[model samples]
Target: MEFHSQQPIHPTIRKCIQHLDVIKADDKTKQIVYMYMESLLRERDLIAASKQEPIESQIHN
Candidate 1:
């Protein structure tokens, strides 16, 4: 679930998420927004971690 990219995000993903964010105005929509944001952040964190050398993998087992 990790993406490895040091450069700027692709326009497609950014725009899609932005659109999703903008579409909701109600409480139910807020729930959707919360889910979307959390997912996006988790994925972004995984991507960043993937880019770095994992500490566990570096040490001899």
Candidate 2:
């Protein structure tokens, strides 16, 4: 849970936290934002993985 000084947080994550704080978001709203963020992160990961795969493999499937 504790992040040491050596490990820096991601900018997107930091921005999300700051936005949530500024809005004084409620629990329900916070949950919605969290879910949206999760989806975005998952999609980004999938895109990155696809890019790493060979073009032939991508074309076949």
Candidate 3:
């Protein structure tokens, strides 16, 4: 997904994704980085949610 100027991710997250000063990332590289970042964010959210839910609820069927 092409991330627009404004989206669900925070400005810092977007900026970090957009501005990686390494060997100079082209469009494809940027997209790859963004995808990786998105996945990381998704995982982070899942972990946070798991933590937020009660341990009993998490263990229950």
TM-score per candidate, chains pooled: 0.46, 0.64, 0.65
Worst 10 residues of 3 by lDDT: 16-25
Record all residue pairs in model 1 with backbone atoms less than 3 Å apart, i.e. clashing. Answer: none
lDDT of 1 at 23: 71
Q: After superposition, which runs of candidate 3 have C-alpha atoms over 4 Å from their true positions?
A: 1-6, 20-24
**In candidate 3, how many Å is residue 46 off?**
0.1
lDDT (Cα) of model 3: 0.74
Between candidates 1 and 3, which one is better according to TM-score?
3
Clashing pairs in 2: none
Pick the TM-score winner: 3
Considering TM-score, where higher is better, how would the candidates rank from best to worst? 3, 2, 1
- lDDT for each of the candidates? 0.62, 0.70, 0.74
Cα lDDT over the full model 1: 0.62
Q: Which stretches of candidate 2 lie over 4 Å from their true place?
A: 1-11
Instruction: Quote model 1's TM-score.
Output: 0.46
Q: After superposition, how far is residue 33 of candidate 3 from its true place, in Å?
A: 0.2
Q: In model 1, where do residues sit more than 4 Å from their true spots? A: 1-24, 54-61
Tens digits of per-residue lDDT for model 1 on 1-61?
Answer: 1234575545555565566567745556545655576678779998888779778876887
Candidate 1: residue 18 lDDT (0-100): 60
Candidate 2 local lDDT, 1-61, one digit each (tens): 2224564655786577668778887767766766677678889999999899987887854
Highest lDDT: give the candidate number: 3
